[model samples]
Target: MAELPLSGLLVLDFSQFLAGPSCALRLADLGADVVKVERPQGGDLCRQLYVADLALDGDSALFHTINRNKRSVAADLKDPADLEAVKRLVARADVMIHNFRPGVMERLGLGFDAVAALNPRLVYGAVSGYGDEGPWRDKPGQDLLVQSLSGFVWLSGNADQGPTPAGVSVTDILTGAHLAQGILAALVRRGVTGRGGRVDVSLMESALDMQFEQLTTFLNTDRAQPRRSAVAHANVHIAAPYGVYQTADGYLALAMTPVDRLAELLDCAALEPFRDRSTWFIERDAIKAVIADHLMTRPTADWLAVLEAAGVWAAEVMTWPRLVEHDAFKALDVTQLIESAGGGTLLTTRCPIRIDGRILTSPRGAPRLGADTAAMLEEPMLDGNARVGE
Candidate 1:
């Protein structure tokens, strides 16, 4: 097999929960030798952050899901000896990631400037709930709270419905993605200049970025808040026929389609009066109500077949079980098996990236807390000036 692009790179993951660790997880997936630096006791807080109360080995499934393909070292940064050892490790790492509030790392003596002084080529990535100088910087950076504060909650649900947050931690995940992108760019720059850089991202910024399209419209227009559609609301700024509607058997999602074309295709004359493009936005609720009634007359599959055959962007809204069973999902080959420290396997997703047309897969799962500490501390490189791959 071709060598992964990030082979021989060393990344130290000093963050917990989702944003920082998710960024580190991607680095590991791309073949970086990522090591998690955690507290001697408990390790990543996410080890106990259970979702559906699922677990594998001794850690929550959520922890195993994000933390696979990485090693762990336990150390108390408060202890002088452990802090010195971590500093040595920092000197050798090509990259390091952390999610701490502003000044926390500085208080811990591991801020970007200090670490860059130790390793000039290090790419330091930091994640915060908000930017360091912002008024909201010190607030807790939890995903749900960030989503609520970033104007994201108002974008979903029908007009009559109250503000609704996404079921997933989209802000955390998107912030991680942004951190990874910035880190990658910094690394590219480092390759040219042989100097490291700091990359910072915040959940609030990422949340706003996730709604760039709608936010851009709001900014460029009269600065009036865009109202959610009264019916089948999907996007705050989109017109009718752009949301999920209940069919006889299930839900069907429709994307942008010409109102006239949809009326002819579905054989519904109620949409005929609102066929003009201008009315699509003004009468979106009425047009969607008519479409909803017409769609309820047929099954989702029946409507999907017709809409699909005509090249209209439509699909049956599928549950997880149904989606996993579909041929299209299977064709993607997105799942993989990873083994925990206890030697048991858990099925999870592989890296979505394909380098050299090869899907990245690692059989290794997350390590036990401090599993590699002894080995790491005993390394001869720590006593010498050499780094990994040197």
Candidate 2:
């Protein structure tokens, strides 16, 4: 069979929590051999991140979601024996990932320079809160804090409400993608140079990068930074009649920004009222005001059918259940279910990419703390003796 992209690569995942662990998870998903290094007890802190009822299960949904397809080895770094074991693991790993506060690794004797001396072919990836140096460097940063710091919190959500927490871990997810890219780039560099590289990414950097388009305009112009817009738009300033419209039962989105399209979609006599002058951008806010009042009459379902028939760019609001039940989703059915421990199955969304007509889906299961401890500790001892079962 053909080689998996990262088949021979080995990763030492010293990171816990969302961003760094999720990056390691992606590498594991792509067939890299990833060994997650965890504390001798308790494992990653994310194991306790959710609602309290699941505490009895001894496994967290978050932990399981981001930590599949990897083996786990537990160690107490302060102990000399454990530290020696970790050093041995680092010697064999192609990549090392960590998201500790700035000096924590150095304090633990696993700093990049120290490890790199032992293993020059190691790709060291680190994710942190603010960055290595900044006003918030030593201070802790989480998804909520960074979300508010980045204008994303204000940029999204309804105009009437104060900034609300995004339901998902936006910064962590973005940072994870960046971390993945950095690791992959290092891997590429290592292939050519025959030496590994150190790749450092931060949540703050990734969070700020997420607002590139908004920041570009705001910084260059005297205009006040755009705040909460009721609608989610790719080009918010240019969008008109460009929001979710209510139908009899649900919502149908309208992206009728182009004047001719807007005119036809709204079924109006003329858009002369909107195209008052060259200051149409200025008039857009008020135009939406008028259009909003008109859309108030119809329910979302009715508007959806009308828009669909009219060939207008529109989509019905998809709740979680709605998305699952949507015809396109049902027809395509991208997500799959995997059996878990205790004879239960876990439903999960599938990975997006396809390779030569094949979609790679790894077995999904949570680690049993230090379940791979014996195998990991004996890799060196077993050496040639380490057959598939060993």
Among these predictions, the greatest TM-score belongs to 1
Q: What stretches of model 2 exceed 4 Å from their correct place? A: 51-57, 230-236, 269-272, 276-280, 305-311, 379-390
RMSD of each: 2.9, 3.4
- Give the per-residue lDDT digits (tens) of candidate 2, residues 1-390: 454577777888888889998898778666677878899878888877764454324676667777766777898889999999889889888999999999999998899999999899999999999999978998776988998877677765557667766788989988988999999998998899989888998888898898888788888887796754454332445556666655456666767556455656666544657754454455555665655565667777666666678777878777888788778888765766644454555566555555555665654555678877788875642221111111
lDDT of 1: 0.89
Q: Each prediction's Cα lDDT score?
A: 0.89, 0.74
Error of 2 at 341 (Å): 4.5
lDDT of 1 at 94: 93
How many clashes show up in model 2? 8
Stretches of model 1 off by over 4 angstroms after superposition: 381-390
lDDT string, candidate 1, 220-265, tens digits: 9999988989889998777888999999999999999999999999
